[model samples]
Each structure stands twice: as C-alpha cells, then as structure tokens.
Target chain A: MILIGEDLNVMSGEISRVIKEREPGPIQQCVAAQTKNGMDYLDVNVGPVKKDPEGTMEWLINTVQEVTDLPLCLDTTNPLAMEAGLKFCKSKALLNSASGATESMETMLPLAAKYSADVVLSVINDAGLPSDADERAASIMESAAVANELGIANENIWVDPVLLPIGVDQRQVTSYLEFIQMLQDLLPGAKSTCGLSNLSYGAPKELKSLLNRTFLVMIGRYGQHSAIVSGFDRELIRLIRGEVPEMVELIYRAMDEENMDISALPQKELEYVKTVQVLMGKSLYSHSWLEV
Target chain B: MMKYEPPLEKISVNIRETVVGHGEKALKIGGENTLPFHFFEGSLPNPPGLALEILDTEPENWAPSVLEPFEDVVSDPVKWAKKCVEVFGAEMLCLRLLSADPMGKNGSAEEAAEITKIVADAVDVPLIVWGTDMEEKDAQVLTQVARACSGKNLLLAPLVKGNYEEIAKAAMEHGHAIVAQASMDANLTKELNIALCKFFPPEKIVIDPTASALGYGLEYTFSIIEEIKQFGLADKDKMMQMPILCDFGGDCWRTKEAKENREQGILWEAITGITFILAGANLLILRHPEALKLIKEMVV
Candidate 1:
C-alpha cells in the first residue's frame, strides 16, 4: 500500500487554526509525525476555511518542505490554490483531483500536464457519483481520454470511483469493489486509488478504522494502486499486507458473507483467530527503560 | 524514450525490527521493505549475525575435516565456546546439546541444564541453545535449560510441531525465545508459527525452515525462505514476520563436500551461509571461523 497521509487538511480544527494564524509549528509537527510514520506523500488541503486559499496552500507546502521531502498531494477544488501548491512543491506533486466536469477537465488537466504531476481523477461528472460499475467505468474512461489528449500519461493518472459511505447503503461496497475491478480491466494503463476513509463516513468514529481497513483489504486484493489514508495506521498497512494473522481472519470473514458474522466463521478460521489473540496477549520480554 | 516501470508494488508491512541480546550485545535484524540487501529500495537495518557452534559432547564420529577447525575446543565445550567469542570475534555462541540425542548419550535434561548454566555464566554474548532433532528430548532438555538460565534471553531451538506447546511455555515462562522449525513447506512453516503464537509472543519467535546442505535440496530451502519473506513483507502475515535462522554449520559440515578436503569443506560452508544470507536468513550458524570471516565480508 502506498500510504498518503490524510492529516494536513483544513478540516482538522488544529490545522485550520494554524493555517489561519500562519502558524508553522503545528504544520511542521503534522508533517513530521506523518513522514516518520512512513507517509509516501502528504495531502495538503487548504479547505474553504482559508480566505486566502492560494497563499495558505503555499504556506502549507513551504512549511512542510522545511521538515521533510515527502511529495505533497495538492488537494483542492480550487485550481489557483492547486497551482500555487504545485509552484511551491519541491518535488513532483500528485494533483489531488480532476473530475469529468468540463470546468474541472479544462483547468486541472492542463495544470497536471504542465507541472508533470500525477493526477487523481474522480469518475464524477455533472450527474454526481456513478450509480454502478458500468457508469463509473464510462465516466473514468471519458475523463481519462481528456487527460490522455492533454499529454498526461495514463500510468501517471490515478482514477478514483468516488466512494459512497457504506454505512448509509451497505450495498455501496459491492458496487465500489466491482467498479475497482472494472477500472483495472477497462482502464488498461491507469492506476486506481481511493480516499479510504470516505467509505466509512457517517459511521461511528470508533468503528471507522475497522470499516476502512476491512474495505482496504478487499480493494487491495482487487489491486488498488494507492490510497489516501491515515499514514499513522501501522496496523492498517499491516492488515493490508495480510501480515497480522488475527486481522487476516477479519478479511476472511468479510469475504465469506455480506453481513460478516465472526461467530459464524468456519471452525478452522475461528480457531486460528483465537490462537493469534492468545499469542498476542503474552509478554515476550522485559527490558529496563533506564538503560539506553 | 519513455520506459515502463513494472508497477512492482512495494511491500507496506515493514518487517518488525527486534534485537537479540541486550545492551551492547544486542543485534538488530529484519527491518527491510525489499528483500535482503536491496538497499536502493529498502533498508537492511542490521547485518546478519554469525554464531560459532560448540557441542556439549565430543563427536568421535565427526568427519576429520569438520573436526580440524575445532581440534583444540572439541573436547571442552566451555573452552570451545570461550574461544569462539574471545578469540574468533563470534557475536554469539550456539550450544548444541548433541549428547542428549537418544542415539547418543541420552543424558537427562538436568545434565544439559547444568552444562547450559556453566556456558551461560561464562559468556557475556547471547547464546543459542540448539537441541537434538528428537522432539521429546528437545522439549525436555530445553525446558530445563530455559528455566536454569531464566533471564538470559537465549534463543532456544528446534521448536517442532509435536513439542512446541511444551517448549514454548517454557520459553515464555523463562523470558527466552524459540526457533520454530518447519519442513521445507511454507504453509507448514506458517502453521508452526501460528501454533507457537498461541502460547508465545510473536516478537520472541524466530523461524527455522530446516536448513539443507549446499548440493542437497538448497533450492527447496531457498524457495521456502523467499515465500516466507514475501508473506512477512508483502502479505503482512504477522506470524510469518519473525527473523529467519539458517543452522548452516551442521548441514554444511555434514555434506559430501566436507568429506573430500579442508578447503572444499570450508568453501561449502561459506557458500551455504552466503546463499542463506542472500535468501533472507537473519541469523547464520557456522562451525568454521574462515567461512564466518568470508561470509561477514559478503553480508554487508
């Protein structure tokens, strides 16, 4: 999994406050924390809170660059702010989105091409999120064609099927997974990605990581190229890699049924899960903290 | 010209970095994103540790070539172990309880523990107490040895399927680690890991997929380690994430190449150790100092 840190957006009050005050302290700390956690790229979203979106984007980019050299994922609907971030980015930036909408393609595609940046293209047109995999595939192909015409290489294009909150309509997961599978086959050279947490929106905050990680494992098997996720989720990446035997059972359960009843899992898998928990509970060693 | 980068997905699961021994003697291993020494894309956090083997009982049946390097210390394991650490710069010592084998002396567990306590007290370096392949004897002997040297954090060996529970409980109780051994099958290796983890912490587990000699089924061992590494990193199989061990000294020294001549024997051991290092073995056990010296140079 290519983990893109989702922390630097203005949606977080602390980040918004720092951005508004032009405070570099919290901004630097956020970048440092995420990079230390192994962020491949950090998403910089100067949301609608910034009265001066363009300047805020530049400040965020510059502030982050001072501490780490991780590529910035320039995230904004505002083309001017996106370009400002691109201008300030010290390395190749991933343009956080382009959509099938005429205005989006006309402005965002050219900037992505001009800057030689990878672009995340959502399959949403004026009609909004596609209702089915076929519609999603059609929309992605259309936007991808525009990107191709602009000299933006297909491999550099990351297509998102625009996830809907699964808690709202549990069936959305089937559609989403199908759409990803379709994108892999139909969109030959383009890569696939998702804002992993978006699928868990409207769910209880505590259960969000579980939902996102479970869904991530599914998409990972379907071959998601990358994901914009909480980079600090060591367990999530571990689960995605199928490393944790206990969490791996969650994947097996999720695959077994739509409702995913753990109690109903086969005897062998349930026994395996129990064994993992028992092993994890034991302390392996004791070390004195005073010694370096 | 535009080139196609093969979209080789980089492994997201960082191999859990763990240290053996404590303070200055601690050796860190297994923190790579790519396979061993693929430093351009990943990091090899620590070099593979080398341990010199010392036996509890003298080997009268040993090939003369295998015995040449240990001519001085072969009679006294304590002296042999000390020479390996003080004279040869061995980072660790592997105390093989060969006398406890049913076909050999079949010594009681208490006797092995007595010898283990002596070695443990004498050496400041970490110890790897390897057992006879006999499961019942290993379980009995290792239990006593682990309890005798409770806090030393020695790496105990050959935790086979039938005896893992008995041995692992002892390991957890005494704060030592166990080398979970499996046949050349990756699935069997994972099963043993999953089974041992039922009673032991994953951090205290090291894997041994049953080392093979250079000319005899080394490829099978190679494929198994490769699959194990892929599962640990690519699939994020936590049970499979433990560092791998190559018990090279016994297998290499027992081969036909060792029977032929001294140089061929040393070369055989060196080649086997180097092959395992490249194939992702984190702890390599060897008998000859020459093979150890050559392997150390190639490992880094």
Candidate 2:
C-alpha cells in the first residue's frame, strides 16, 4: 500500500544541479513536501554524475533520511551509482531495475542478489520491446524465470510491463493490465508495478497527477504495488473509477488525436466527472478546461 | 497417348496433434481435408496462423516506420503477445527468437530454451518456434526447446536446404513440425519437399516458398506457390503436398508495398492482397491486424 515517487531523478537540468551542489534545500523541500504529502519512498536518481556520484548519492540519502524513516527506491541505470545509493540507505530499499537482458541481468542482478533487494524486472530483453499485451506477458515470464533461476524468491521480484503514455497510445494501460494478470497467473504471487506518472507524463499539468492516481487505482486493483506519483491531494485519492472511461478517452484524445477540445463538450464532461466523484468518493472541482 | 482421368478424388490430409518426443506441449501442423492448392471452395479448416516477431537485441535501431507502432511491444514481448491474442485475436502464435542470432546478441542455446518455455506457458495456443537464422545455432537452440517442450505440440520452423537435414532430423526425433523453406522455385521446392519427406514425412511438414512482396520479388514467389499447387493437383506428388506457409507480413513490410512510397507506388495494398491468395498459402503470417482481418474475411 506504500506509494513511491519516481520524479526525483536528475534526468533534467534543475534536479542535476540540486544533487551536485549539495543543495539539500530544494531536495529537503521535496522530501518534506513528499513526506507530508504521504509518499512512502522517494526514488533518488542522479543520472550518471560519476565525478562525485557517491558523494551526491550520500548527500541526498542523508538529507531525505533526515526528514523521514520512509524507505528509498534506488533509481539509476548505472550499477555503481545504485551501489552507492544503496550503501547509504538506512532501511531496506527497492532496486529500480534488474531486467531480463544479458547486460541488465548481468549488471543489475548481482546488486539485487547481493542486497536481497526487491526489484523491478522489466519483462524485456535484447529482443527489444513488444507493442501488445501478450509479448509483454512473455517478457514478464522471461524475467521471472531469470529471477527465479538466480535464486531470487518470487515475492522479491516486481514485473514492469512498460506503460505507454495514454495520450500517445490508448491501449497502453490495457496492455499493461493484461501482463499484470498474466504475472499473477504465472508466478501466482509475483508483484506487479509501473510508475503511475508515466501513464500521463506529457500532457496538461492538472491532467498529470489526477490521471496518475487514477491509473494507480486501476492497476492497483489487480495488485499494483508502489506507483510513482507527485501529490497527495484529496482529489487525487478519492478513488475515482466511475467516469474512468470518459475521462480516459478525453485525455487520450487531447494527447493523441487533438481532435476535440474539452470546452466543446460541456454537458458530457460534467456528467462524466460527477460519475467519477460518485464512484471514487473524491470531491472534484470541474474547471471549464475538462469540459470536453 | 495419355488417357484422360477424372479429377483425383479430393481428400483431406490428416494433420495430427504431435506431442514433442521430449517436452511438455504438443506439436500440430498437418490436417488436410483435401489435396494441397485445391481451394476450389474447399474448407481450409484451421485459420491462418500468425507468428509474433521477436528481436535479438533491444531493437534500438528498428526501421522507424515499423518501430513507431510496435514501440509498446518491442519494449516487452510477453505483454505484446498477450495484446496480440486478446486484442488482435491471433489464432496460432509464432515465437521468433530473432535475438538468438549469433551476429546480434550471439545468444546461447540455454537462453533461447528459457525464453521459449516462458512463452509456451504464457498461452495455451500451439507455438511455432523459429531458430535465429543460423544453421548450427538454430539447431542447437531449437533442440533444447524441442526437448524441453517434449510432448507439447509445437513446430520448430525454417529448416532450409543446407540446414534442413540436421534441424529436420532433430525435429523428427523430438516430434515437432519442420518448415521447409525454398527460394521461390517450384522445382527447388519440390526437390526440398521430397528431401524433407524422405526423412520427416510429408504429414509432419509445412512449406515456405520464401515470401516476397508485391513489388520486390513477389511475382517469382507467386509462381513458385502456384506451381507447387499445380504439381500437387496434377502430378500428385505426395512430398509437395505439405501445407504452404507464407511470411506475408514480414515480406510485405520489408518490401515497398506496405510502406509509404508516394512516387509511382501504385497498387500497394491490392497487390499485397493478391500475392498470398494466389500462392495458395495455407497459413499466412501477417503483421497488420487490419490487413489480417481483411484477408480472413476474404478467405471465409
């Protein structure tokens, strides 16, 4: 039931400086806000700052740990950075990845194997990504088999069937769910997860967090553990499921088709948002922007 | 002075469900209700099969045109297959271990066997496991897979001329179907089919005359298929009677027809449509779901 955020990664310019300058202020602020907002873990990724990666990782770990006892999810494609971050953690942490590919399996598994880390194994390998649900399931099975063979218990492995942003592909969420169900069937007790924010990453601001939480709940019903999100707003957590189809379609169009503006569809949006409020029990504010 | 004879009594070839002599599932590839190419309104029974393409690497450099739509799939093959079945309604699935190619991942036999098992258990449908395009390597890789899925009805495919002898022998010992690939030549196809049936038997084989697109080399491919059917109907050679397989989507997508060719690219879709039908391909492997649907409707 713990929610983690994947946004703290230094994949961008601003967060990179914040980590290297040892500016715990912005990060400390992030820690306090995210902790207060009820995030269970803040994924810390410095995006390959080798010159002083360990130093940077130590500072963020110390700063974030100082604020709360919440666990940390180590985020980095670099094995050494992940090692440095894990070295500094106070509590048992989750490894962001240890996928099925030769390189990823080779680089990431030892860390998880050595640390007894609960990790995300992308159902993927050198064969590249699949565009549909069955291949995603195959990737999950492939990953699970790899993990099981490496002596990782089924419970310790979480499969990520990469969710495409709905704005770009509507079947993104559906395909992900299908894979999740297959994992449950194949491994029976395997953990399933995806960063919630990735579901609506490139879109209107308000739509991002709101859609994030919604995606979290849908996949959560099928046993989604640990989504990546940015807020703890009440509207975000009211469990809005009723108007899901409508809101999802609208946002999908806005992001993918650019066909109809929400303002043009007033009666439809209001009636739909009300259904979401009723189903999820979240009190919602319907600005005219969501009208379509 | 040849005497005229009545049309050879049309009869169905029994496609038996063959369990791998070594593994967990069963192999199935033959069930002919009539002579090969006698589509004179006879029921083909089983729907055309689809093989899900898997790359040997992360597919970082896939052709941008084809890669864009399948971006979701390439990132994860298992999920992609599930979507193909649930959403696209695929009949039979092909697991191409493209990554196991020696040049690419140089993937090992053990790795291919492991992946094959995962995909086999992920769905209940029969599988056609392909070698990663290398003779000895494919034989080694598919040998483990064929043994592992022992008793499971799966087909280990693309056993070409040079490679066919060894792979076909393994497939026979392990109880799997062999896809005899030919270079779009009726005579070569007949020769190869005879060579394969000499050891594996016609009932345990399918024929791949080597798919070619509408504009590229499809005309030659079509002639080969038509000729194969003509031999089956007229001369009645038992070896050439194996069901024909076509990698239609792979060929179509690879050629200029399926892609966008603005200048002088006339009859793209229509030509692609006619190629498979004319070849009398029993199981046509296709990529686009829309195209598959259209073809399925046409066949029905």
Candidate 3:
C-alpha cells in the first residue's frame, strides 16, 4: 500500500499550532516520525483554510519539504490553497481531491493538469454522495472525463468512492467496496485510495483501530491502490506490508465464507473474523460487536 | 501527412530502488516506473547495471573463446576480480564460489570466505557472491562469506527456497543485500519474495528468474520477466516489485554453438543480455568483456 500519513493535518491541535506559529520544529518532527514509520507520502491537510489560505498553504509546503522528500498529498477544499501548495511542491504532489461537482471540476482539475500532479477524484456530484456502487461509478466516470479533457491521463487520477462512517450508514460501506472492485474495469489505468479512518468516525476510540485495519484488508483485497492512514499505527503498517499472513488469511476465509470451526481460532484471529463479518454486514455492527 | 501519437500508459508503482556496495561508487538500480527503455512513458532513474563473472577456482570445461580474456588471472580469484574492474571496466563483479560445491572441489566454508574477502578488498566496485547450486553447501558458504565481508554490502546470490533463511538472516545482520533465485516461474518468484520479505527488507532483495541461453528457453524466461514486471507495476503486487537480475553467462557459454565458435559465442551472450534488458532486467551477469561492451553500448 502507498501509505499517505494522516498525522500532518490542521485538524490536530499540535499540527494547527505549528502551522499558525510558523514553527518548523513540530512540523519537521511529525515529518520525520511519519517517514520513519514507513509512510510513502505525507498528507499536508490545512482544512478549508478560510483565512489566508494561500499564505498558509505556501508556508506549510515549504516547511514540510525542508525536512523530507516524500511526496505530499495537498488536502484542502479551497482551490486557491491547493494551487498554492502545488506550486511550492519540490516533488510530485497529489491534489487531495477534485469531484464530479462542477465547481471542483472547473477549478481543481486544471490546477492538477497545469502542475502535472496526480489527483484524487472523489465520487461525488451536485446531488451529493451517491446512493450505490453504480451511481458512484457514474460520478467518477464524469469527473474522469473532465480530467481527460484538461489533458490529465487516467493513470494520474486516483478515484476515491467517499467512504462514509459505517456506524452511520452500513450500506454505503458495501457500496464503496463494490465501487473499488469496479474501478479497474471502469477506468483501466486509474488508481484507488480512501480516507481509511472515515469508516470508524462514529465508533468508540477503542474499536476505531480494529475497524480501520479490517476495512483496509477488505479494500486491499479488492485491489485498492493506496489509503490515507494513521502513521503511528505499527500493526496497521505491518498488515499493509503483508507481514501478518495468518491475520490476512483469516480475513480472506471470512470473506469467502469458508467453513471453519470458529472455536479453533485464537482470540486475536476470532476478533478479526468478527470484524470482517461486521464490515461485510453478515453480522450487525455495534460497539459490542467484538464481545458478541 | 498525419501525425501519430503513441498510446502510452504510465505505471503507478515504481520498482523499489536497491543499493549495493557503499559510499561513492555504490550502484543503485530498479527505480523505473515504466517498461525498460520506455522513456516516452516514465523515468528510468538508473540504467541496467552490468557485472562480469569470475570463479573462485580455475574454471573447468570452459569455452576457449570466453576463457581467452581472463586466462592469465584465472588461477588467482583476487587478480581476476581486479582485472574485471581495472582492465575490463566492469562496474560490478559476481564471484561464483564453484570450489565450494560438495560435488566438486568440496572447499571449506572458511576457504571460500577468505578468498571472497581478498577479492572484495581487491576491487572498488560492488561484488555479488554467488554460491554453488548445492543448497546445504551454499547455506554454509554464503553465510560465512556474508559475515567475513561484514558491512561491505556485497549482494549474496541464488538464495533459493531451501537455503534462503540462514543466508538471508546473515545478509541482514551483516548489512548485505540478497538475490532470490527462482526457476523461470512467476508464481515461484513471487512466493520466494513473499517468504523472504517476512524476515528481510524487500528493498534489499533482487529477483533472478533463472535466465537461459538465446535458443534455450529464453522466450520462456522473457515471458516470466514480463509477467513479474506487470504484476509489480500494473497490479501493484508488492512481492513482485524488486529489481530483476539475470546471470546467463554460464548458460550462454556452455551451449553447443557458443562452445565451438568465438564470434557466435559473443553475439549469443550479447544478444541474450540485450533481450533480458528489453524484458526488464535491471542487472546482468555476462562472462566476456566484448559481450559486456556490446550490451553497454546498446544500453547507453
């Protein structure tokens, strides 16, 4: 997996403070930590900077680039900020998103093309998030067409099906998984990524890690190219690196609905089995799903 | 006149760049994101590296044409290694420990280690210490060689299924790289890599899918190489993403046509080397200096 580190973001209080004060210490420290933790790229997310978006993005890009050379995923809603970040990137950058929504298509895609950066094509439109896999596929196809018109090739466009909180909408989780499977057929050379933590947004803190890890295996099995993931999670990195074959094998069996005596499994393996079941909607999801 | 625009698709994942040797002259290979020499599509950060092969003991049953270049220093592995670097302009050398074969001279692991240390010290370029195909002997010989040249970053070759564990561990502990050899089968190649990555860093591993002479299963080798590259770059299969190494010199020289003729042998080796380059070989091992020169000219 191409791991984009989710630690360097304005949403975190420490990162926000560093961004506001223009202090290079905390920012560079975070960059070093993520790089050491096997993150392939670091996400510079100054969230929807309504004030001084350009100056803030330029400062963030310069500060982060000073410490490391891993590619940056410029994550923000403001196109002006996105452009500012893209301009200052020393290596190739990923434009965190452009969507089927006209406003985003009109602005972000062109900047991605002009800067020769890869882009995240979120499956969304003016009608908001798609209801099912087919609708999500259609929305992405529309956005991809516009990107192609702007001279961006299919391989440069990474499609995200807008993973929703599984706790809030269980059905959409399956839809996105289905959309990931449909991606290569729909856009042959395009890649896939997701904000992995979104699946665990409404879950308890203790259960969030399990949900994220389980869903990563699920999506990766379906050929998802990359994910915006927690840089500090060593076990999650191990799973991504294919170090835990037993865990991955157990999850695959659960997905395949293989007949195995659940009683024979160890405690940790049983938890993964339950998590896979919950993600697949074979069992109901609740805070106490693991207990059940 | 109508202009033609080639249909080009860039691969998303790059084969991991692996470094061998250390410091100023260390060679790096396999960071390309496209098919080899497909510069129109993606970057080839480093060209394919070429290395000349030398035996730890005087070679036996060798082709006269291929032997002529190194006949003077063939008895001394140290001088032979220096000749490859200083005279032949070889950037890398693969020292095959043929004497350690239990079926042959049955040399001791310590003897192989001592000779390897001397040759490695004699040459400034990186060295690839290839073991005899005997698994038990290789496990013993390569482990000693790896530890003897500690921190030299020599690439230990032919770490097959039966012997990878002991050798890979020693290579990791001693800060050396490894070449995982699989028969010309894509699944076997991926399986060996997946197994090796459990204990070793994937970037320190290279794949040798068992190269063959031009008419001797070369097409089969080519297809397997192409498949490995596709799985790595297109399918983004991490296990198949390491740089490929082809050591076909021994196979090419031992052929009937190559053994009888001189120019035919050089072209056979050069053509085989060039074919592997086109099929995505990141490093090649050739025996003749003339063949290496021919391939190097084409590579540049």
Error of 1 at A137 (Å): 30
| TM-scores for all predictions | 0.53, 0.45, 0.53
Model 2: per-residue Cα lDDT over A157-199, one tens digit each? 8777887765445445566766665667777777766667676
Per TM-score, what order, best first?
Answer: 3, 1, 2
Residue A220 in candidate 3, Cα distance off native in Å: 24
TM-score for chain A, candidates 1 onward in order: 0.85, 0.79, 0.98
RMSD of 1: 22.3
Alpha-carbon shift of residue A95 in model 3 (angstroms): 61
Per-residue C-alpha lDDT of model 2 across residues B1-300, encoded as one tens digit per residue = 999976656544333322321333233333445433455735455544444444433465333555554567766667666766677676667778877888777777888888777777776666778787777787788888877776565777788777788777766776677788867765456557666766676667788887777766777777777766655644455556677777755555555433564121223433565466656666666555555555666654
Q: What is the lDDT of residue B35 in candidate 3?
A: 89
**Candidate 3: which docking quality band?**
incorrect
Which sections of candidate 2 miss by over 4 Å?
A: A232-234, A238-292, B1-300
Isolated chain B TM-score per model: 0.94, 0.80, 0.97
Per-residue lDDT of candidate 3, residues A189-291 (tens digit): 9998889999999787988988999899988999999999999988899987999988998889999999979989889999999899879866545555665
How far residue B180's Cα lies from its native spot in candidate 1, in Å, is 0.3
Q: For residues B189-232, write the lDDT of model 1, one tens digit per residue.
A: 76677777666888888899988968878988888798789778
For model 1, the docking class works out as incorrect
Candidate lDDT scores, in order, read: 0.79, 0.64, 0.90
